[model samples]
Target: MARVSQAHLDARRRQILDGARRCFTRNGFHATSMQDVFKETGLSSGAVYRYFRGKNELIRAVAEEAFDRMRLAFESAGREAPLRPLDEVIDGVLTRALEEQARRAGTDRPGAFAELILQVWSETLRDESLAATLHALYDRMRVMWVVVVRTYQDAGHLRADVPADHVVRVLMALIQGFIVQRAVFKDVGGELSSGLRALLSPEADPHYRG
Candidate 1:
């Protein structure tokens, strides 16, 4: 019998993760079973178990994948050529995120991405290990956002009156609020995108005299 190649193994893992994502999205983490994941993937029990030992492990992997995607999006916003306007950077990030969500929606996974994130948040409340892991990831993300925000401040786009940490905290709160609202109330994408740009724009603040 031939052994599976590394590429094949990686592909199989992604397949399992995708199925797990859908299952958790449709049914909350506590309600989703390994059988549901197996059914979602259309894979044999043995194949599913080979990738994830149980639902807990599968959910953790799903959470990691979600945050990794978010991290990439945030990093991209900070990396435009010649430094675009702060509002434009924010719009770029929001547009990419919403586009990805729409791509999932096109596949009959409408709102599943955001739903899965809410599922993770609920799971974190009851799972100490998962909570710690996600806390660390959020901390790292906060640090990244600080860098992004400070970069803008240094570029004279954002006000220096607010500390980077404070600014990032408010931004993160707005983002989380938008995600929750978008998940529950469909069609808020346009409003949320516009709000993000407006909130981050320099014009939102009266010119600081200090």
Candidate 2:
């Protein structure tokens, strides 16, 4: 048999995962089956199975992909350090996530990630291992954010009085709230960047020109 290229193998694996994402997006995690993935990929059962052992494995992969996007955003902010404003950094992450999610949605319907996240959360409730996996990803992201916040505090950009972890949590809460609101409600009027900036500090008003 001819040897397959690594790039080809990676592409095939991604194809399977992408198909699985669409299936899970359309049918919820529990409702989606290996057969569903097979249909989605238009490949033989053996081909899909070769990449993923079963539906559970596929679900884990899909969920990991979703979580990684958010994690990278946090890590990117951390790398930027004191140079980037906390609110702007966070808004950049949120904006990128929303844009990528909307593009992946392949539809005009807003809140695609919001709806998919709810489905993942429901699955996590039933699956302890999955829940643990998600928790680990979250904890890692939290640590990254805390470091970023502390860096800003040291630079006198953010208040040093508040605990770094506490500030990170509040900022995360705002992002989460934004995700939920943007996904559920169609018209989330007002500038999210300005709102997030104001949340970071009262002096965050964007309109001041002096």
Candidate 3:
């Protein structure tokens, strides 16, 4: 038997993941069959097993991919953004996530990290491992929020005595609350965004401008 190179193996794995995600999004987790992934990939069941042992394993892989992608999104945002104040950093990230989610709100993008997140939360009773992956991702995102908090603290925008880790927890909770509310309602107060901006803005804005 000819040995597959690492690059070749990685490419084939990516291909299988892509097809599996499409099927999951189209048919939903419960509805999508292993055969659906096989059909999507045009690979036999045995060949698919070579990449992923089962559908659950595939879901875990997809979850890992989703987290890695989101992390990349934040890293890209950090590089491209103008370094002005801390609030801009937070808004930049939240805006990206919100926009991406809004795009997938109604669709059957089961492969979407956001959709997978909801499914994992709803189905955790039956899928512990998937739920663990999601919990880990959420915890990692909190670290990003903590960095923003420390940035503001360093800029003298927030009280120096305030704890960065504590602030991150508060911010994460705030964002999560908004997401839950937005799911049920059409409009959340724009004032919330304006308030966040004000919180990060220099209090002596008028005097500093002069």
Candidate 4:
């Protein structure tokens, strides 16, 4: 038998992962079976099993790949000499996320990736291993956010009095809320950047009677 090159092997692995992502996006983590993955990839059960033991392993691989891309995005953004504005960073991330989701779903429709993330969140509720994987990834992401918050604080774009960690949590919440809204509602009117600016503004409305 002719030996397969490492490049070919890697491509095959990616093919399986892409197929699994589509399956999970469409049918969700719980409903997608290994057989479904096999059909999706046009690979035999043995071929799919060679890369993943089961659906859980495939799910882990898919989730990690998604998070890894996000980590890289944050790392890239942090490399700017003077970090970009918070709103710009958030908007860029959101745009990239939607584009990635569209590519994964093989459709231009919004929220495909958001729906996949929601499915993963639901799965984590019952799967301790998945939950741990996500928790560790989130912690690492939060560390990135801490760096971002401190940069903004140093630049006087954000309040220096507030704890960086607290700011990080709120930033994380904003992104999470964006994901939830996109996944459930599909049409989240208004730019996230605009909403963020309104919240962060120091001036109060004169019309408020409270």
Q: What TM-score do all the candidates reach, one by one?
A: 0.87, 0.85, 0.72, 0.91
C-alpha-based local distance difference test score of model 1: 0.76
Per-residue CA lDDT of candidate 3, range 32-112, in tens? Answer: 889889988898999899978898898788766755666667655645333655455555665666556434333432124
**Each candidate's clash count:** 0, 1, 1, 0
lDDT of 4 by residue, 1-210 (tens): 999999999999999999998888888887888889999999999998998999999998898888778777876776661456677777676768677766876767668887777788887988899999999999998898788778877776777777999988998888888988888999974568898877654344443332
**Candidate 1 backbone clash number:** 0
TM-score of 2: 0.85
What's the best-to-worst order under lDDT? Answer: 4, 2, 1, 3
Q: Rate the local accuracy (lDDT) of all candidates.
A: 0.76, 0.78, 0.66, 0.81
Which of the predicted structures, 1 or 4, would earn the higher lDDT when compared with the native?
4
RMSD of 1: 2.4
The TM-score obtained by model 1 is 0.87
Q: Highest lDDT, which number? A: 4
- lDDT (tens digit, per residue) of candidate 1 on 134-179: 8988898899889888888877677878999999899888878877
Better candidate by TM-score, 2 or 3 = 2
User: Residue 60: error of model 1 in Å?
Assistant: 0.8
Candidate 2 weakest ten by summed lDDT: 201-210
Per-residue lDDT value at 19 in model 4: 95
